[model samples]
Target: MTNRIERLNELDSYGVLNHKQDEELNDLAKIASLALNVPIAQITFVHDEFTFVKANIDVVSTESIPGRVKRRESFCHHSIKNPKETMIVNDASKDSRFINNPFVNSDPHIRFYAGKPLTTPAGNPLGTICVIDNKPRNLSLGEKQLLDILSKKIMAYLNNKRKLLNQENKIIDDALRLQNLTDRLPVGIFQLDKSNQNNLRFKFLNKTMKEMCPSVNTNKSSESIEILFSSIYPDDKNRFINHLNESFDNLSFSNIQFRIKKGNNCAWFAMKGNVERRTDGSKTFYASIRNIDNQIEYEKTLEQIAFDISHVLRRPVSSLSGLVNLVDTKEKLNKKELLEYIGLVKTVSTEMESYTRKLNDIYQKKKEIITNHNKSYT
Candidate 1:
């Protein structure tokens, strides 16, 4: 639970204190002044140091008088002191608190005051809407009830205004957070509207996405999906589009491996995304694109090594095994045949050695590619 001062600070957070006078608030004060036939009706906001007038209406005109007085002299301050209830002084001259008060003893010569405490939904008293009279008087029960109801309306307006301000701030914060998260990620994130296949539009492209394909224009709606496809190699672009459409139609996940044209160079990328069906029967896709040139190259190198082992080395190894079996079966082979078998085995062993050198060369190249790629990204 917050005390009076703490509650005042929370009220201040809404920025309503000492603000430009509102005509609407002034009109409410006018209505109160007219109904009660009082000289002055005010909507006041109380702070630790002062009671500030938000709306002040006289019986003749509903014009606001904006100023502040010390908290001790403020009638609204006493209203807020009592929680959840209006404070009334039929004759301030007879009250002990106001007996020696400057406002009561001097200018304005306050003699009568009746105030309903304005409160937040959490029951924190903000200030009051009260009427003041120069002559000692009392408010009818009907007039007091009207003031109470008017005070509640004023609080409702303040609460609604605060909600709108908070909502606007939350939207701004969310955008900044989204940008921060995407900017730090290594992979590019994107969103594309496929609602109209003929006019596939780029809905969003984060910082990484912009950097990944510098050639593609990032302007939303204006930049078509063709601009993105243009960055991709011609041979792979069609296949990529086809696979994406298939995924969209099936409402399944999309995975695409393709080559992107980067100026004079080409890079391999792996892209994955999912299509979201809109309530209007339209669809959008959110995706990530990662530069996988190094990964793809390394995989290709491994495949080549496997191919050499199974095809090139396997043939020679098989021939050597057959020759060895023939030699073992023949108990007494001729010297010429034995020498020929030994020569054949040497040839087969040299071929296998060549395959090993090829594999080693591929591995060294793959390692250099990986190291250089990492440095480029970093």
Candidate 2:
């Protein structure tokens, strides 16, 4: 049990104690009032100096009743002292504890009283389900039992309502966080529901997607995916579709490079996605689109450079090998002539080794550059 003053102050802090109305609470009060045949049944909260009715079944003129009344002056306050239990006073005037109370003896008297305390999740009492009457009357055991059951129902309703509110708030918070992340991403992100008649639609599109395809409005429902694919290069469109189908059918990640016509220019794009099959024999995919035109062009240029180096080195290497073979196979000659031929063979061998080293270095560097670029795009 909490100190009466402390409990009253805690009730005030709930904010629902005063000027808050709920239709559900009012319905509960009405049911309790009818079951007990009481003119006044209320969900009340006790503040520092007063008991405020949060929900009432009947019209009551008075408000802010004194909370710190003496034991002999307040039946409602005494009833809520033990929050864990219900207090049923069949006749307040007949009860020895509240018979001499000033409120009962004077005007706006309380004769019949019954109250069940309301507590929070932490077991702190906030208010009560109370019934009062101007005339003294005894209630049956059945009526008391019904009032107790109604109080428990009211508590359950409040608990469930609070849980629902918390869940709703969490959902809203998660949505905002997801939106923030999507907006900041540099690549185009989208989801496709392949379940709908082999048609791919964008379930999500990031800010980058809007910027990349300014003419493709995602907000419209009639935007056909086929129309989008039609913009792709004729030679690459079938291959791109084939790759996408294979990935989805095999439940593997798909990586595709294709060219699309953007205005008068042709641009290349790299797409990566994962396929997911639902329980209902339907599939979906999530993908990221990236502009890889510059990367592809750079790769082509590197390949051409490697080819040119190989072409230039091929003639020199062949000539050097022929000269070495001829020098080794020739008949005996003068000492000076033989010595000069040997020196010429050594010079050609050295030149061939240098060209080979340069070729290997270029090949290794090109591989490294391509690997790094692929990693970045992925």
Most TM-score-accurate candidate? 1
TM-score of 2: 0.58
lDDT of 1 at 104: 77
Worst 10 residues of 2 by lDDT: 63-72
Per lDDT, the best of the predicted structures is: 1
List model 1 lDDT by residue over 1-378, tens digit each: 448667977787667885687887888989888889898899888888888888887543333333787988888877887757778898889999899987677766778899998888777888889998878888888988899889888888888888887888899999889988887889988888877444577888877777777766655534788778778888898899899879878878998899888778888889999988899777888999999877877788788778877886778789888998888999898999989888998998988888789878878987997889867864
Off by over 4 Å in 2: 1-27, 39-115, 131-144, 160-189, 194-199, 205-254, 259-268, 274-282, 288-302, 342-378
Clashing pairs in 2: none
Clashing pairs in 1: none
Candidate 2 lDDT, 1-378, residue by residue in tens: 777666655554444644556999999999888878777788876665556666776545264344233333445566667878778776667778877777677645777788888876667666689887878776678877787788788878877876776688789999879877986787777776776467676666666666556555656534555645776777898998888889878889988888877678777888998999989877888898888865886778678777866896777677777876877787767899888877886877787788778777876787787777556544
Q: Hey, what RMSD does candidate 1 come out at?
A: 5.4
Quote the positional error of residue 50 for candidate 2 in Å: 12
Give the runs in model 1 whose Cα sits over 4 Å from its true position. Answer: 1-5, 12-42, 48-63, 67-113, 120-123, 132-137, 152-179, 194-203, 215-230, 233-253, 310-315, 318-322, 325-331, 334-347
